[model samples]
Structure formats: structure tokens, C-alpha cells
Target: MAYTSLYRRYRPDTFRDVIGQEHIVRTLVNQIKSGNIGHAYLFTGTRGTGKTSVAKIFSRAVNCLHPVDGSPCGKCEVCLELALSGNFDILEIDAASNNSVDQIRELTDKINFPPTIGRYKVYIVDEVHMLSKSAHNALLKTLEEPPEHAIFILATTEVHAIPATILSRCLRFDFRLVPTSAIAARIRFIFDEIGVEYEEQAVNMIAAAGQGSVRDALSIADMCVSFCAGNVTYDGVMEVLGTSDPVKLVGFVGNILSGNVDEALKTVAEMCDSGKSMAILASDVAALLRNAIYVKTCETAAEILSLPEEQCAALRALGEKHSVQKMLSVLKTMTATEGEFRYSTQHRILFESAVISAATEAPAAGTTAKERELEQKIAQLERKVQALAKPGFKSAPAKEDAVQVWARVASELQKKGAAFIALAATEAEVESDGGVFRVKVGSSSCMKILTDKSNRDLLNEAFSSVCGQKLVIEEVKKLDEDKSLPYITSMFGKYLEIK
Candidate 1:
């Protein structure tokens, strides 16, 4: 016998064998049992979620001379006849290749003909969204009023592309992604039937790599069966997936979370030397961090993750040692690197940079960690001052000097939670002119902050509180000569004589 791929060989032939779409199955089963089948049906979902498979099964069930619980009895004459490859009752159309108006017209023209061996002539159109606009228009009329003996089943991954007219006329059933646990169990059953020796962790790993697609998971299992020569191990599955060993990944991420840049880089170099793709490495590291977070927070982490006991224990231990924020930060960096890899040729360099950035707690552009720390400290001090300077307290006497009054205004601004404005005010020169406070700032950045409407309002309120009277505040640009040596010497007088 010729060889067959695992996915194709294990494809579900009946509704009972389908997984992870019980809602759709139940409704369809009830429809079949109640003899309430619709003329037009739409099955929509991601690829490998069994939309097409279920469509085929539903077609057979409707035409079956004997249906056992809404599924076709394969032994019946109608079911056996429809099972043939050349069955005239069931027609499978690939809209991707025949997506023309003429093709759709031809299909519609054939709608008048009844089924050769069954009650309904079922038309299964895969990738129906690929049809052009005119093709959709051509099919719309027939779909709206098809013959009683005709059943139309349209399957598409992108249902948004389908016309609303077609959607409104059809009974739409959304197929959901199969759960990881269900896929894992299916893999175990297949492995046992195929006589393949495997580790439980290996099955879970393959199922997870499927990302909720049964066909994708089985395809991966096929590759694993071939590569492992009938014995699938966890490490073998990791190699097939181009992912790092769980132990090594745990250690590598541990180094990163602990801010050990040197050790983390060494681990990266080692993985690169082993021929691991940098993109996959980043993805695997991110997945590990996400799993660790789940393990730490979720009560049903082991069940949700579907990880083996040993790996779960290791992840639990790792999660206990690191904070979720730190892990999420690193995971964000890794995810960004994965996206950047598509645009850059230097994957290794990008991955290493991300690792270093995550490890070192890289500050924002043009700002050092020390500067951020100082800003934070200033904010804390401002909060403490505001808490101490509550209402109903006696106000301090108004100062006479312009500089002293400006200092009091700045203090008042800090109490009002304008710390940045207060800091900028320290670098500005203030003067009293006609009972108005004139502020002169040399730096354009400082001027920008003081001139903002909200900040200006804050300054006005602060000046009123400090000066014991409401005053109009005006922003003024300092003269160039104000920075000259002569001007400075005159302002300082004999207290600071020029050399």
C-alpha cells in the first residue's frame, strides 16, 4: 500500500469524530434529526478547524438512506454510493481555481439538475471568499432561490470578503479552534493505533505547536514520527520545532530576569552555534515566559498549559523566583524582535540586542536611569509636601524680593502637583512689573513648558496663593545681553568683581 499522511489518513469521516465544535455539531445534528435542513449553509473558521470536513459529513447525512443519530450510516445504499470519488450527488468545488463569473454561472446553471443517487445535490465550495465580485453577484440569485433538491455549502476562512447578501441568505455556522487538550488526546490515540512509542510531553508539545489546528498538529506529528523513527521524545519534538530545550530555555530566561547579561549572551551564542534560528529562539523564549506567568498566576496552570509534570514543576520554580512584570517586559522585547526579524537580515544581532535590552532595564531614549530615578524622587518629595501643606493652615508672610516670591510660587506649584513646572520655574528669572509677575526663561524647552495653557493656569493660581493677591502672569524672552559678562558683573555689583 502507498503511504498516507497522518492528517489525511485520520481525517474525520463522520460528525461523531469531529473535535472542538460541539455547538455547531449539536445544532446540525438537531437539524438533521428534525428534518429541518436549510437550502444554503455557510461554515466559517480558521483553516484545519474542520469546516470542510463537517460540511462533507453533513452532506452525506442529509442524503443518507439511513442516518444513525444525524450521521450517515455508511452501509446504506445512498451513503455507499455518495462515498465514491465520482459521486454526482456531492460536488467539491475549489473556488480558488474557479473564481470567475463564468464558472459561477456554470455552477448555477447546473442547479436545476437533481441528485443522481441522493435526494439533494450538495455543492461544497471551498475558499468561497476567493470569488470575484461578479462571481459573487452571479451566485447570489441562485443562492437566494435554489431548487428544493439542491443544497449549497460554502466554506471560507475569510468570511468578511463574502457579500452580505449571500451571508443573510445562508445559515452560518462558525467553527472554533480545537482545544489543546482535545488535540493532545487525539494525538495519543493516533500514536497508540500507529504503534508509535512516545512520551506524554512530546504529544503535548506537538499539540501546542499546532496552535488549535487539528490538521496542523497531525501534520507535525507525521514529521515527528518519521524523524524519530516511531519513537517520539520531548527533546526530539523540540528539535523538530526548532525550539531550544526546555531546561536550557528556563536557564537562559533565568539569566535574563536576574539581569545577568553576560550569561544570557553566552546562552544566545551557544544556541546560535547549534544552528537554531534566531527568530524561533526569540519566539520560544517568549512562549516560555508566558507559560511561566500562567503558572504563577492561574490556579489551573498545569491543565491549561498541558505541559508535562517535570516541565510544569520547573516552570513553577522559575516563576517563584521572578516577578510577572519583569517576565512580561522581556516577553514584550522578544515579541518585538520577532516582528522586526521580517524587515532585517541580521536576526542574531536583533535577538542579542533585545536580550541585552531586557536584561539591563534600558531606559527611554536620551534619558539615563539615574535621571529617571531623580525625577521619581522629585515627584515623591512633591507629594509629601502637598500632604503636609493642607488647607486651614496659617499662610506664610508674603516675601518682598522678586526671586524670593518666585521661590514661594514654585513651592506652591509643587503643592498643586505640578512638579515638572516647578522644576522648570527654578531655571527662570522672575520680575514684578505693574503688580504683574513677568517670567523670563532663556531655554526654549523651559519656555514651552511654562507657556502651556494648563501650566500657565497653575502658575497663576500658585502666584496668587504665594503673593496674597491674584496677579496676571506673562512669559518674556530674556535678552541676549542678559547672558553677557558685563550684565552679570553689574547684577552682582562689588560682591562679585570681574577679574
Candidate 2:
């Protein structure tokens, strides 16, 4: 016998064998049992979620001499013959390859004929969305009104590509990706039946790496089976996936947040030395950061994030020390570098830069607790400052109109020594507090320059000079702008020059 891939070997021969698509299976099985089979059926889903497998099973069941509870009984004459002689009456067409009008015309010409052995002639069209407009038009009429003996099962990963008219003619079944636990259970079943030794974490790793695709998981499991030569472990599977251990991801995140740049870079080097793809490692780190954000902010983190128990617990424990704001800051850094990592071959440099951005945004590691408290205080104040920048902003009687306040402060900033600061804070705004002045600069870069006590004091004297009142300098923050790409570009260029 020739070698068969795990996906094909483990293909669901019956409705009960298919996993994670209970809704679709139940409806189809019920339809078959009640003899309410439709002429045209559309199965839509991501790959490896049992759309094609269910289609095959349904084709067999509807033609079985005696189906048991809407499932095909393999021992029957019709089932035996159809199983032995492939494509007897079951014409499996790859629409991706044969998606031309002539092929569709050929298909339509034969649909009127009756099955040779089974009760129904089934035509399974895989990737039916690949059909051209003319081809779709040719098949539309036949699909909408196929002969009693003919049944069309159209399967496509991209269902939106199919026309609305074709969609309307068929009973559509959407298949969801199988959950990790279910995929792991199936892997365990496969390993047990094959008499292979494997660790539970190894199975989970494979399933998680599959991203909810059972076929993809099984394919990975098959590779692991060959690579490990029977005994499979998490590390072994991680190597195969070109991903660093999730533990490393957790450690890398901890190091980044704690501002331990040397330790974080060491971890990246270790992964690279071990022949791991920085792209995959970056992706893994990003996922853990996102999970950390969810764990820190959401009360139902476990419900929302599909992670192992111990991992989720560890994340939550680590997350308690961090703020939701900080996590989002790091997440933004990760997202910023994600596309760059894909295109640039300087993976190490990009990874380091992203880590630096994430770290620099965080409070200093020495006095983290106190700094976080102060940062949160500033964050709250910044929100008020933002509101003040908006049009029609109102404040207490002592507080001047925000626009007038900004105009006075900006003019004060443009003096001799603070000229550079004034240029950057062109659109700076101010808020009054009896004697304290809160100046919200145009952006963080501006804050970096103008927040120097000397510069701010100079501005304070000028604010007093302009507004004719003694005022103390207090706070600073970036102005909020929904359109700020030019600022990002300018700031990024400055960072490149500085670094």
C-alpha cells in the first residue's frame, strides 16, 4: 500500500466521526434521516474543519442501502461498491483546477443522468468559489434545478467569492475551526491507537500551533511522529513549528516589561541560535502580550483566551503587577514592528527596537510601583487635558478658555532659550489651577523638550508675563489627534538618528 497522509487516513467516514461542527452535522444528518435531502448543498468554512469530510459522508449516507441513524452503514452493497470503485457515481471535481466554462458545461450535461448503483448521484465540487463568472452562470441553472438523482455539494473556504445567486440555491453549512482541547483529544486518540508515547503538553502545543485547524494539527502531529520517532515532547514540537517555547515568550515579555534589555536580547539570541525564526518568535511574544492585556483587564480572561490552565494562571499572576495601559503600550509596539519583521531581513534589529519601544514606554524598573501610581495619576490628568483641547471645552470660572490659555502659553514659549521648545509645541495648550499651570504639549516629543524644569519655569514666567499672574508649572502631555501619521514618521526618523 502507498503512504497516506494522516489527514486522509483519519478522514471522517461517518457523521459521528466529524468534530467541532455539531450544528452542521446535526442538520445534515437529520435531513438525510428524514429524507428531506436538498439537491444543492453549500459547505463553507476554513480548511480542515470537516466541510469536505462531511460532504463525503453525506454523499455516502444519502446513497447507502441502509443508513443507521443518518450515517452510512459500510457493509451495504451500494456502500461497498462505491467505496471499492472510486468515482463510480460520486464525481469529485476540483473546481480550482477545472473552473472553466467548458468544464462546467460538461458537468451540467451529465447531471441529468441517473446514478449507476446508488440511489443518488453526488457531485462534490471542492473550492467552488474559484469558478469564473461564465462558469458560475453555466452551473447556476443546473445547481438551482438539478435532476432528482443528482446532488451537488459545493465546498469553498472563501464563500463570499461565490455569487449571491449560487449561494441562494443551496443549503449553506458553515464549519468552525475545531477547538484546541478537541483537537488534542483527537491527537491523543490517534497516538493511543498507533501505540505511540507522547506527553500531554506536546499534544497541546501541536493543537495550539494549528490555530484551530484539525487537518493542520494532524499534519503537524504526523510530522512530529516522524521527527520524534515515537516519543513526542513539547520542545520537539516547538522546534518543528519554528517557534520558541511559550515559556520563553513569557520570559521575554517579563524581561521587556521589567526593562531588562540585556536579558531580553539574550533570549532573542538564544532563539536565533537555536535556529528559530524571529518572525514566529515575535508572533508568539505578541500573542502572550495580548493575553496579558486580556488577563489584566478582563474579569473573564480564561473564558476569552484559549490558553492552558497553568499558562493562563501564570499570565494573570504576572499581569496583576501591570496596568492595562502599559500592556496596550507594549501591544502597540509589537503591532508596529509586525509588518516590518515580515519584509525586513534585519529581524534581530527590528526585534530589539520593538522591545526598546515597549520597555521605554513602561515605568522604570527600580521604582515600578511608585512610578506606576504616578503614571496613572498623569494618565488621568492627561485625559482632562485632552478634553480641554477639544472644541467647545468648558472649565471652572478660574480656568481661562483653553484656546486663549494656549495662545498665551505658546507666545511665552517662543522666547530666546525656549525657541526650540516653542517650535515643537506650536499647538500647545494650557489649563490654570489657581496658581499652577498645566501645559499639554503637541506630542510626547514636545513634552521631552519643554518638560525640563528650566524650560517650563521660563514658560511659567512668560505665562505670568502674558496673563499677568504668578503661576507654577505643573504637568505636560501630548495632544490627542486622530490623524497623526506625519508625527509618527518624524518621530521614527528622529529615533533612527539618535540610536
Candidate 3:
């Protein structure tokens, strides 16, 4: 016998054999059992989620002379013919190749005829979304009122591309990606049944790499079976799949959190040296970061992290130490660099740069506790300063308007050698108590600079000497809503009203 790939060899013969889409399986099986099969059916989902497989099984179940509870007996002539030979009644068309209107019209012309040998003539159109506009229109009419003996099953990974008119004519069933645990268990069983020895970790690593595609996982396992000479190991599978080392990813994340740029770069360099694609590694890291963020925010091992119990606990602890925003920050950095890594000649350098941006960058506003507290403090100071500048800002002059206040702040900042900080603090209010003058800086960056001990003291001494009294320093944050400025020249006009 010729060699068959693992996916084909282990193809589900019955609904019970299909993994990770139980709800869909149950409904289709029930339909077959009740003799309520629809003429037009659509199976839509990502690749390798069993869309094609389910369609084949459904065909066999409907045509089988002896179907055992909605399952093909596999012994009947119809089941045998459908599974082995090219049955005229069950035509599997590659819509990708025959996507033109002529091919569709031909298909429509044949649909009116009765099944030559079976109860129903099934037209399995894989990747039906590839059909052109005219082709869609041609098929739409037939699909709207398919013959009694005709059944249409359209499958596509991209459903949105299919027109609503075409979608409306069929009974659509969506297939979800099979879960990792289920895939891993199935892989383990397949290996054992084939008398191949494999490690549990190796199985898990394969399952994770599969990304919820059972066919893809099986294909990978097939490669592993051959590479390891029927005795699969983690190292052999990783080498075959060209996947990044989990240990390297773990170390890379740790180095980033500890702010060790050099160490992180070294790990990235090693992965590059191992002949691993930086783009692949970056993607895996991003996924791991997402999981960590989920673990951190949810704090429930059972619901969030998919790792083993011990691994989940470790991830939960890491999540507790880092804020969700921080995790998201890192995740975004990795995501942004994924495309860069794909295009970069110096991948190591690009990966390192991405890591640095993620680790040190501040979390988004209102996300972290520390950031929110700082933001609140800055906001309160801004409100106070703005109130001072409004018409009834104080109902008393006491000397400076917005201009003089700004000038005082600029001069003090200059004296303190904080030129940049002072330059940015272009707008502010100055209040005088005897010889002491207080500056309410108008910008967050300016306020940050003013809060520095060196700048604060310098501003106090400079303003105090000018006023001939000790000056006190104060900072106010800028506000989001702009207030109308009440000019000191029109002060009396506003003041009388204020009184």
C-alpha cells in the first residue's frame, strides 16, 4: 500500500470521530437521523477545522444503505463507492480552479438531472468564495431551488467574501478550531495506536504549534513520526517544525520584565543562531504574553490559563506582579514588530528593539494603579491653577495675571538650568504671599519638572529675591476643558459682576 499522510489515515469515519465541533456534529447527525437534511448546506470556518471532513461524512451518511444512527456503516456499497471510487452522484468540485461562470453554468445545467445511482446528488464545492460574481449569480438560482435529488455543500474559510444572496440560500454551519488539549490527546492516541513512542511534553508542544487545526496537527505529527524514526522526542519535533524554544521565550520575557536589555538581546541572538525565524518567535511570544495578561486579570487558573495546573499557577503569580496594562503594552510591542521581523535583515536587532519598547514604556492611562494616581494628582493641581486665572478666579488681584505668572516660572526654570522644562511650561499662574511667589505650572510635563527638588528650590529663591521675601513653590495640572481667559485690563468689568 502507498504511504498515506496522518490526517488522511486518521480521517474521522463517523461524527463521533470528529473532534472539537460536537455541537455541529450533533445537529448534522440529528438531521440525518430525522431525514430532514437540507438541499443547500454551507460549512464555514478556518482551514483544518473539519469542514471538508464533515461534508464527506454527511454525504456518506445520507447515501448509505445501512447507516447506523446517522453514521455510515462503511460496509454498504454506496459508502464504499463514495469513500473509494469517484461516485458520479457525489461530485467534489474545487471551486478555486473552476471559479468562472461557464463552469458554474455547467454545474447548474447538471443539477436539474436526478442522481444516477444514489438517493441524492451532492455537489461539494470547496472554497466556494473563490467563485466570481457572475458564477455566484449562476449558482444562486440553482441553489435557491435545488432539485429534490440535489444537495449543495459550500465550504469557505472566508465567509464574508461570499455574497449575502448566496449565503441566504444555504444552511450555514460554522466550525471552530479544535482545542489544544483535545488535539494533543488525539495525537497521543494516534501515535500509540501506530506503535510509535512519544513523550507527553512533545505531544503538548505539537498541539500548541497546531494552533487548533486537527489536520495541521496531524500533518505535523506525521513529520515528527518520520523525523524521529517512529520514536518522537521534543527536540526532534521542535527541530522539524522550526519552532522557537519555549525556554528561550520564557527567558526572553523574564529579561524584559527585569529590564535587562543585554540579556534579552543575547537570548534573541541565540534563537537567530539556531536558525529559527524571528517572526515566528515574535508571534509565539505575543501569544504567550496575551495568555499571561489573561491570567493576570482573571486570577482564576481554571478559567484562564490553558497550561498544566503547575504552569498555570506560575503564570498567575507573574500576572499578579505585572499589571494587565503592562502585559498589554508588551503584547502590542511584540505584535507591532512581527511584521518588522519578517522584513528585517538584522532580525536580532529588531527583536531587541521591540522588547525594549514593550518593557520600559509606560502603561496606557487609567490602566495601571500607579499611572492613575499620578494622573489624578496632576489633574487636581491643574484645576486649582485654572480657577485662579478665571474672572472670579480669586476676586482679588494680588499682582500677577497669566502672563506675569508664566514669565516668573520661565525665569525661575531658566535659573535652575531646567531650560527645556521651563520652555515647555509656556503657560502658568503666579501667586504672591509677601515676597514669596508660587508658580502653578500648566502642563503635566512642566509640573513633573517643577516637582524636581532642584527646580523647585531654584524657582523659590529666584522669585523670593525679586519680591524681597521667601517664595513658596506650588504646581497645578493642565485641564482638558479650556476656560475663557479674563484679561486683567477688563478685570473691573468682570470683578463687579463677580461681587
Give the TM-score ranking, best first: 2, 1, 3
lDDT scores of the candidates, listed in order: 0.75, 0.69, 0.67
By TM-score, how accurate is candidate 2? 0.68
lDDT of 3 by residue, 1-499 (tens): 8999989989999988899999899999899889998989989987888999999889888888888889889898777777765556777776655324333334444555676666988888888765555456556766766668878899987575577898888899999867779888999989989999998888987875676678878988999999999889989988987756665566677677656778877887777787777767787787667566555544342332335444455566666566555666787687667645545688777877787777677544444678656545533433333332221122122332323354555555565777765554443456655335566554444566666787666655655554444454454432112111121112112112221
Q: Write the per-residue lDDT of candidate 1 for residues 16-106, one digit (tens) a residue.
A: 9999999999999999999998999999987888999999999999999889999998989999898888776787776665324333334
State the lDDT of candidate 2 residue by residue for 1-499, as single tens digits. Answer: 8878888888988888888899998998899889999999999887888888898899999999899879999989988988974445787776655324344344443555678889898888888765555456656766655778888899987665677899999889988767778888899999998888999999988876665678988999999999999999887897787666777678788888877888988987887897777766666676677677666555555543456666787798768776656766786677557546646889988888888778877473543678667656644443333333332222221233334455545545653556675554443455654444555543344565666778766766766665543553332321122212222222112212110
Tell me, by lDDT, which candidate is best. 1
**Candidate 2 C-alpha error for residue 154, in Å:** 0.8
Model 2: lowest-lDDT 10 consecutive positions: 490-499
Query: In candidate 3, where is summed lDDT lowest over 10 consecutive residues?
Result: 483-492
Residue 230, model 1: lDDT of 91
Q: Residue 288's C-alpha lDDT in candidate 3?
A: 67
* TM-score of every candidate relative to the true structure: 0.65, 0.68, 0.65
